[model samples]
Target: IELNAFVAYQREREAISDSAPARQLFNWCREAGLNARGLEHALLLRDRIGAVCRRLGLPWVEAEPAGNPEPVLRALTRGFFGQVSIFSSGLRG
Candidate 1:
């Protein structure tokens, strides 16, 4: 899912071509239990969806972690930094 999402992202950014990953993505998604119609719909909207995800800084979890939290943390921070708020204060006003 992550790999396909990245490939779709690249395609949306014009860094890759739409046809490049189609077969592999379809096969992988099929094996992962995604139906044909769903895949078709996703592909059809890949450009728009991918662009939106990119613009919104959404995380795609691109790699498999081996008991490591670094990658996941990085992705999350990059994606949600703008939306996360941290406040430090004392009880007294």
Candidate 2:
């Protein structure tokens, strides 16, 4: 689910590279399932992408908070369960 959201955000941002907010939104999406170390890596990527977009004067789409954290949490939850499903399924006949 987290990957899905990332893919969706990537596609949306690709469609609109003239807005800074769009890039910011993508940054937020990338940080979704990250830990402290992971977040740092994500920040680096976000900063680099944002800088390039800004330098190029591109429009970026920003992500609006999904109103609540449930959706974002749910995506992470799905990703967790999905992984478990794959591993456990392999153990079954």
Question: What tens digits encode model 1's per-residue C-alpha lDDT throughout 61-85?
Answer: 4346534557757867876764443
Instruction: Give the per-residue lDDT digits (tens) of candidate 2, residues 1-93.
Output: 343444555565456556585456546555664343444466578789899999999976554554345655776799999999999999995
lDDT of 2 at 47: 83
The candidate that wins on lDDT is: 2
TM-score, every prediction: 0.24, 0.35
Query: Which prediction has the highest TM-score against the true structure?
Result: 2
The reply for model 2, stretches above 4 Å from the true place, is: 1-36, 44-67
